[model samples]
Target: MVVAVIADIVGSRRLRDRAAAQRMFDETIARVQREHPLADQPLQPTVGDEQQGVYSTLDDALAGVLLLQLALPEGIEFRYGLGIGEIRAIESAHRELTDGPGWWAAREAIETVHARQERAVPTARSWIVAAPGQDEGMESRVSTSNAYLLARDAIVVRMTERERRLAYGRIGGLSQSALAEQEGITQPAVSKALRSSGAAALLDGLALMTGERS
Candidate 1:
């Protein structure tokens, strides 16, 4: 089965300048493609402020989504929907269009996140829906996967700009001391910020996403 991630800007219409936001959104997607480069179908802006991509595994898709989320500029946030299943069709060649249960599930998942956001729910930015009958334990696995995403997104949404940079760097495999050098802060100060800002917990969650932890 393939994994798909569909994401859209949180408040595109409300933004003062749609053109600038679209430019930033496109740039963020390009950066993610360069840095992550794990998607089987590279992430690209499909329409307006929304983008979609396909990955070989759930871990890669989750990693890509988090990286893109962090790569976004200040005052810009996006919600994600992840799905895992077979692709049934490609509606367009040049546009890399696709039609499948996987895409449908992803669309449903993103809509769910949007509804949650509209209701002011906490940790409402990401959701996953594995295609039915893909496996006997699909339901249980989806629950566990979404539980992790909920906890991960909770920490992510609350991080300040500095904290986010630290978390992103750490997830990219940088040590605290290395990040300190890069951020021009003392090692101890970097450690303190990471601890206080939930970066440590977030990294652990990322490890879970990457299957580096039990």
Candidate 2:
């Protein structure tokens, strides 16, 4: 099964400078493309502030989403929709266009998130929807995936900017001492920040997302 990821900037219309936000959005997509080699294709801007991409596996797609979220500037946030199914690609001279059940399902998921946001649902940033009849166990898989994203995004949304920076550094394989040096803090202080900010829990959650742990 192929996983499709579609995301757009949250509250993008409210930004005082729309051009700067668009530039940052483009830069974030470029960074994700450069950093995430597992993506089926580099994420491309679709319409307005939205971008789309495909991944060979759900785990890789989720990882790429997390990377993109963490790479953005402090004031920027994104909502993600992940769908698992078959994708049909239409190749053109300029770019490869994609359609099919996968894209449709992803659109549905993103729209679901948007609706939740409109209703003021807390921590409703990421969602997953499995394509209909994709598998006999699709229901179970969708439930588990959405549960994971809900808990993951809930924790991430509560993180302070410094906490997010530490989490990003830790995920990139930086040691506590290395992170301390980068942050100009003591190693003990870094440890305190990680613990207090729930970075360890976030790491564990990411491991579960990647199927590296139960």
Candidate 3:
């Protein structure tokens, strides 16, 4: 079993330079993969405006997508769906194909997030669903993870570009002084942004999820 993900550009039609936006998206995904190394298959474009990836665990999926959210540049955004289940490949004469419960769950998740975005929660960017055969323990995890995703997306949507960069840096193990140098601000200012922007709490939550804390 694995955690599968589906993602797409949030406002594809409105992008001023579609090519550049895609390039940046690809680069950011590469950087996240390099820094985090959580994905079983690193996120990559699968078709027009869409991407896919695989993770070995739900925690990895959660952390990977969060890193992606912060690594992406201003004016570019993507929504993600994560699924936990089995996946299988279909043999094609010309090309490989993918199918199975994991992808189906991921599809459901993405559609759910899209619906949520159109409804009351416009900032919703990620959602999770589990395959029908998930055990009781897995189902409980799915419930808990969904709650985390909602709060994480809400905090991320409110962050300024600088705040996001700093948060991303912190998660990648950068010091506040280093982030301040990159942002051309004082180290104290970086600390203030990390606190005022809700990033510190988010990092703590991620740590707990990843077993970095008890």
Please name the candidate that would achieve the greatest lDDT relative to the true structure: 3
Per-residue C-alpha lDDT of model 1 across residues 1-214, encoded as one tens digit per residue: 8888888888778899887887888787777677668778866678777888888888788787888776777788889998888786666756555788888889889998888878877567999988777776777778888888777788888888888888777877788899999999999998999899888877777786677721
Deviation of model 3 at 49, angstroms: 1.6
Candidate 1 CA-lDDT value: 0.81
Tell me the TM-score of each prediction against the true structure: 0.90, 0.91, 0.96
* Position 103, candidate 3: lDDT: 94
Q: Relative to the true structure, how large is the alpha-carbon lDDT of every model?
A: 0.81, 0.81, 0.91
lDDT of 2 at 93: 94
Worst 10 residues of 3 by lDDT: 205-214
Ranked by TM-score, the better of candidates 2 and 3 is: 3
* Candidate 2 residue pairs in clash (backbone atoms < 3 Å): none
Reference-based lDDT, residue 23, model 3: 88
lDDT (10s digit) by residue, model 2, range 82-149: 88888887988997677888888899999998887678676788888888886667777678878777
Task: Report the error of model 2 at residue 7, Å.
Answer: 0.8
Q: Roughly what TM-score does model 1 have, to 2 decimal places?
A: 0.90
Model 3, residue 78: displacement in angstroms? 0.6
